[model samples]
Target: MLYIIQTTLTLGFVYSLVALALFISYRILDIADLTTDGCYVLGMAVSVTAAYYGHPIFGIFLAIIAGMAAGYCTAFLQTRMGVPSILAGIVTNTGLYTINLMVMGWSSNVALLKKETIFMLFKHLGIGGPWMDLAIVAVIVIGCMALLRYFLSTRLGLSIRATGDNKDMVAASSINPRFTITVGLVIANALTGLCGALVGQLQKSADINAGTGIVVIGLACLIIGETVMNGKKNMTRNILACLIGNIIYRFIYAIILQTRLIPIDFLKLVTALIVALAIASPSLKENFSLYARRRKESL
Candidate 1:
């Protein structure tokens, strides 16, 4: 049970980065950037290739750069080439498959058994076991949360938020909506790439299919966070909500797995169901209340 809890926490922290990325794109920028799936694999591909060359830190940097490039392509398609945002993301995502394969030397997977990774560095420094994993992930998550909170308070960040709230208003206020959207996506995808690189290092392997359904997962986490932390006005609180929501989601999954009632093959279905319920909850509640009131009136 303790092991399960620890594992859940570790995965929660790792995936919180993805949730943060979604928060930026979906919640802040009001853009459903479907490039998440492709950018994730791109990050793993770049980081794994770098790690294979004995520079794991450099691998992370390369992953961020690759992600930003992917974001730039997506943004260019949307803003400059007159492509619809969703279509642009789909196009970039489709193209990234070939790019990811090329980065992996035309391979579909890369393994890092016995390789020295960032985590291993901690182990070598007398920090071993699951505690080290938890500590490392905690530090990264907290640091990211702080940095994001700070960034979102900046003048440019306010412009990005305003763009999401009202694009026409922002444009009329002398802020370029196009530039804000581009910057928001670049930063969002960079965080996602960082998450992917860390996940690769954590698992000691990078697989082409690892990024499948990531956008759904990230969106689900984001919705769950908003649902749980409803009406919170503070940016820090909202960021914390994202992290906590991820941990809670993982814990729920862990509990379900322990029951042995569902097959591993149906896990994705379960995730979809959870997301559906979260998305529908508010409407469901309203309808239920209305029905109850109508029944009482009829009585």
Candidate 2:
């Protein structure tokens, strides 16, 4: 029981980073950037490759740089080349497959053999006991939430938010919507990359197919967070929702895995159902309210 709780908590924090990315791109910028799946593998490929080469810490920074570059590619296609936002993400994601393969030395998988990971280093810090891994992930996630909150409150962040709300309005005000959009996408992908980097280091391995359907998972997590707070627009509430939602999702998922109620093969399908239900919840509630009101009137 303790092991299950710790595992769930650790992964919950690790994956919340991807939820943060979707929050910015989907909720904030209102863009469906499909680059998420490939970009995640890209970060993992870079980080694990670097760790394989004996530079575990430097690998994380490199992964961020790589993620930023991937974001720039998508942004370039959208802003300069006149590609549609969704298509731009698809193109970038498609291109990342080859790039990721190259980064992994043309291999489909990579692992750290007798190598150190960021988690191992944190464990050695003498601050965390048996839960050192969970502690490290918790600190990183909390710090990210803090930085993201602070960033969203700044002038540039406001511009980015405004661009999401009304790009034309921002442009009319001479705020340069193009620049803001580019910056927003760049930052969002950076978070995704950081997530992949940390996940790779934690697991000490990277696989080409590991990131499949990751965007859906991230969106699911974000929507779960939004639903928890009743769709409130307060920045603090929304951010906390990100943390709370992931933990809740992980807890439920852990329970399912522990109980063997569903086969491992069907977990993804169940996850999709959960996401669909969460997405439709608002409409469902409104329908129920109307039905109850009609019954009351008849009575």
Candidate 3:
């Protein structure tokens, strides 16, 4: 039980980074970027393959670069080809499936058993063998959140946020909304790729399907965070919400797994339902309040 909780938190922290990427494009940019599913897998494949070649750190860097390329592809379709934003994302995502396969060098996947990964560095530093993975992941999560918070406070960062808010207004200010969107996508995808690499390293394998429905999972995290943190527009609150929501989401998943009633095959469906409920909760609450008010008026 304790080990399960630890595993959940470790995996959850890596996933929270992906969720943060979703938050940047979805909530901040108001764009539905579906490239997450493929880019995530691409990251894992790139890193694991690189590790197989005995360049583990370089593998991580390659994954980030690959993610950035995926981001650029999506932005290019939207900005240069004049495709709809969502459609552009879909196109990039479709292309990435092939790209990921190529990165794996015609292999279906890669497994890095007995790998010397970032987690190993924690152990080398005397962080304790049993707790090393969790400790490393926790440090990475905190570092990312802090870096993102600082970036969002910068002038360019403010412009990016503004672009998400109102593209036309940002354009009117001569900020070039397309540039902002492109940069935002690049940053989001880069973080997501790093997450994938780290997670693959932790798990000791990278499967082509590892990133299936990743966008949905990220959305679930974002919604859960927003609900728990009340969706405050402030930077600090929003970042903190992502962290808290990630921990809670992992705990919920752990609980569900413990229940013998839910088969492993049904897990995806249950997760989807949970995400749907989280997304609808605010509207449901509003409707209930309106109903109570109507009853009072009638009385």
Candidate 4:
């Protein structure tokens, strides 16, 4: 049971990174950038391939670069070619499938059975033995949170936030909304690539389909976070909510899988249902309130 919790926690942190990335693109930029699915897979392919060639750190960095490049492509299509944001994202996402395949040398998948990874470094510390995985992931989550908090407080970060809130206002203030969007996407995808690379290391393998449904997972985390936390007004608080939501979400999934009440094969269905309910909770609450008001009037 402890091992299960630790594993869930570790993967939760990794997923939180994806949530953070999604938060920037979807919530901040107000764009439904679907490149996440393909760019995430691209990261896994590049990182694993590089690790296989004996360069772990370089591989991770390269994965981040690839993800950023994919974001840049999408942004270019939107700003330069006047493509709709969704269409631009789709084009980039579709292109990344081929790019991921090429990066993996046309292999459908690759495994890192004996390769060294960041997780192995934690094992070397001899801290909690089987629980070391959780410790490593915890440290990573804290570090990422700190870095993001600092970044969001900077002058440039404020501009990005403003652009998300009101593009015309930011543009009137002499800030280029297009540039902000481009930079935001780059930063968002960098975090996403890091998440993908970490997951690849955790699983010790890279599969072509590994990134399937990642956007949904990320959105689910964000929605779950907002729902549980009451949507704190502070940016830092909201970001923390995202992290907490990720852990909780994974823990719930772990519980469901462990209970054996539902067949393991139906786990995805359960996840989808939970996410849908979470997303609809706010509207449901509003409707309930309205019904209550009507009942009082009728009475």
lDDT of 1 by residue, 178-211 (tens): 7999999998899889889989988888899999
Ordering by lDDT: 2, 1, 3, 4
Clashing pairs in 1: none
**What lDDT score goes with residue 10 in model 2?**
92
Write the residue-wise lDDT of candidate 4 on 69-145 in tens digits. Answer: 98899888997889999999889988888888898889889999899876776567666678666777778778888
Please count the clashing residue pairs in each candidate, in the order shown.
Answer: 0, 0, 0, 0
Top-scoring candidate (lDDT)? 2
Sort the candidates on TM-score, descending order. 1, 2, 3, 4
Determine which window of 10 residues in candidate 4 has minimal summed lDDT: 118-127
TM-score, cand. 3: 0.92
- Residue 194 lDDT, candidate 1, scale 0-100: 87
TM-score of decoy 2: 0.93
Give the runs in model 1 whose Cα sits over 4 Å from its true position: 284-299
| Runs in model 3 lying further than 4 Å from the true structure | 122-127, 281-299
Tens-digit lDDT track of model 3 for 200-243: 88887889899888888888887788788987669888888777
Q: Which is the better candidate, 1 or 4, if ranked by lDDT?
A: 1
> Relative to the true structure, how large is the alpha-carbon lDDT of every model?
0.87, 0.88, 0.86, 0.84
Give one digit per residue, the lDDT tens place, for model 2 in 1-299: 99998989998898998998888888889999889999999989999999999888899989988998999899999989999999999999999999999999999999897798887886666767779888888898899889999999899999888888886688677787779889988988888999999999989999999889898888787888778876657988888887778888898888878888888688788888888887788899999999999999999
**What 10-residue stretch in candidate 2 is worst by lDDT?**
121-130
Candidate 4 overall lDDT versus native: 0.84
Decoy 1 TM-score against native:
0.93
